[model samples]
Target: MSGEKLSLKDLARKRDLLAPGHRLCAGCGAAIVARLVMKATRGPTIVACATGCLEVATTIFPYTAWRVPWIHSAFENVASTASGIEAGLKALKRAGKLKYDHVDVIAFGGDGATYDIGFQAISGAFERGHDILYVLYDNEAYMNTGIQRSGGTPKYASTTTSPAGKVIPGKLELKKPISHIMVAHRIPYVATASPAYPLDLMRKVRRGLEVEGPAFIHILAPCPRGWRFDPRYTIEMARLAVQTCVFPLWEAENGKYKLTGVSRSIARNPKMKKPVEEYLKRQGRFRHLFTPENRHLVDEIQKIVDEEWNWLLKMCQLS
Candidate 1:
């Protein structure tokens, strides 16, 4: 809650609320993100997951990978459902009918659900000031539904819907600034995290849970299958995303922003930022952008990344 660093043993000692034996793809970043989030909580937690890769894979039929109480809600209503659950719990506590004094409620959704179809519900929950943590396991595209382009998909990344060809190169639209959107709601906590940095992610998760009102974490989860990369490069790709400033790790609390992890260092020294190409070249989804004809698209993507990084630094008052 205080941004205290957790030792490896400390993290290891925490119970794995999200158990193993699920059907997530090999090296799936969403699973890693969920596990880390579950490990960071201090007490009983109820998780509401939207219909996506995480929900479908973890709660298949009778078997479930979740060790804690979990609910599988509709794609566009995870936040709303979690809000209802929070309201119900509060009502029970008010009537002295609840056994537990404290319980953390969390909602898990993919980019398609959080950044696209579910945006309205998410925004409404934040506006209503629900005591819940909404985490977006953003693998960019809608990986669960055949790798379609979603609002979170980065520009110039090819997806099943946004195919690279003679016409449009890739997803021409820029990635939706979901974290900023959440910050605009003036919530207690808003953060962008990557599974590559588990400690930082855990710290943010802990901080979010400690807050009194709504909290949102946007995680840049890399998809090895959809990204067309080797399963082993999931963490590496996530690291590259942060190092390249493509996905800056930062948190906004009550409108005040602070860069974290490698992004904090990069904020102090912009020269330390890695090229966006380093992050893109590894993923096959952006492979076509490297072609001679499509080289401009890569430059365009770089420009957007730089603008966003600079703006983030400005928001944090780092520059």
Candidate 2:
């Protein structure tokens, strides 16, 4: 996994680490993200998954979708469990009981697990500098648990817990800045990715595994059922998220930031980016924000997007 871009042919030849026939929802972005991440691997890897859609759908009573070794840990301990596995492997190798020179340990969690319930464990793992990669499939709300609102839910987006109402619109608070939070840990690698851009996502996963210390990749996985979008438009919504500067694709390595994928151009010329309204209109969760009385909320969301985009550009030294 050098800096060189992998050809589609080369990527196609790789074994499908996540086999088909799973119960994941059709057009589920998390499933796509998992497949691409596993396909990018160059060697054997172990996966630790939090109790989320991925885990439930992939590992039903008597079947599984994973081709490689995988562990389904509790919702709040995916990172810590992966860290322990990494430690055990290190000990085994040191005792000359293991022959392999390297084996990647990756943990996967949804927004509820990563941003709320599992935050402490994930933070501890990063703080301890464990040799593991943690990937957060941020579908905004808790899609698997009746579409409850989580910390990752964007402002004005409707959810089960934060439903739109007369007095209080949708979610009143903004989405958590998890990417910057991870950057604050000063880990070896921290990246933002989307399933719309498979190559970029794969590249980030590959880079994250290549690093020695703890690494993190936050992926914006759109939910068709929760977001109220067409199943076929999952990738389109993911692309719009990046094109509108609502979710930028970038990475921070050793505390230095650099834009990747379509975000590079958006970082250079903000005018090239699409309007946040375009992205909002495509999703039903934010449909309430389009009203004349609530139109100001759209402007507010746009303002926040601009502020965050500018902040990212400044951090990347592009502004």
Candidate 3:
């Protein structure tokens, strides 16, 4: 093994791999996620970004926040574009025409691209067994364009399209379990991480990079303006997400599940999980969830989360 100790903090520096003069809004989670991810990955790592907030905000005209070779693709073509790059890299490596043998390919996309628009392309890459790392920095909604509901949007989280009203209280359906869907792919590695959990997130990123086949890391990123929360509370909101069981940090490799980031009291905490209302109450998006019927709906969602957690505990042997 190399002499490098495994420390995400040691690995990540705040000295602007993405740079300090970027155009991201205050407390932009995508920008933070991008920086952390780039910091974790060493060598000639190339990034392919879709047409989203990060792409537009970072790269305007001749300027860019990225220090590595980065490409801007269409909204739904990041995965496909990354696949092509991977293929070319392989061919070049095979022909002894490539400069670096440690080149890692990464594709970054928002929730809309990963969960809805670019999903097929992502699925195709995985099925084809492309050797690349696809990171979905999920802010839960189509944040690039006004806050609209996407497949990753949690139940009752208000968006512009799924606005709360007298009868309709934001989104009525459950959040799409994209990490579970990646597990269904039976790929080499699959993990769910959050920006708040930077060390854990970087650990998983390193593991995924070491894997031979396709890998997926879904990062739960918080959007301040989109979620109607104060920009300063982004980290707190993310921490609460895992604490409340709204988001679980777990991994599935070679069909075996492993749950991480469990609180001290497993049984008691699972049964007495923090109310979804608490999470919703932080953001104005879910203000309606505080109402009687909507509060009940939020409870129902919590129950579903409990059931899933219990099942995962058995499948993954969580304490």
lDDT, residue 281, model 3: 82
Sort by lDDT, best first.
2, 1, 3
C-alpha positional error of residue 293 in candidate 1 after TM-score superposition, expressed in Å: 1.0
Per-model tally of clashing residue pairs: 0, 0, 0
Where does the lowest 10-residue lDDT sum fall in candidate 3? Answer: 1-10
Q: Model 1, range 221-254, lDDT digits (tens) per residue?
A: 8999899999999999999999999999999888
Q: Kindly give the stretch of ten consecutive residues in candidate 1 with the minimal lDDT sum.
A: 1-10
For model 2 the local lDDT of residue 292 reads: 96
User: When superposed on Cα atoms, how far off is each prediction in RMSD?
Assistant: 1.2, 1.2, 2.3
Residue-level lDDT tens digits of model 2 in 1-319: 5635766789999889999999999999999999998988878799999999999999997999999899986999999999999999999999999878889999999999999999999999999999999999999999999899999999989999999999999899989999889999989999999999998898888899999999999999999999999999999999999999999999999989999989998767768899999999999999899899999999999999999988888899942
Would you estimate the TM-scores of all the predictions?
0.98, 0.98, 0.93
Candidate of highest lDDT: 2
Score residue 222 of candidate 2 by CA lDDT: 94
Q: What clash pairs does model 3 have?
A: none
How accurate locally, in lDDT, is each candidate? Answer: 0.92, 0.93, 0.83
Assess the local accuracy of residue 283 in candidate 3 as a C-alpha lDDT between 0 and 100. 90
Look at candidate 2 and give me any clashing residue pairs.
none
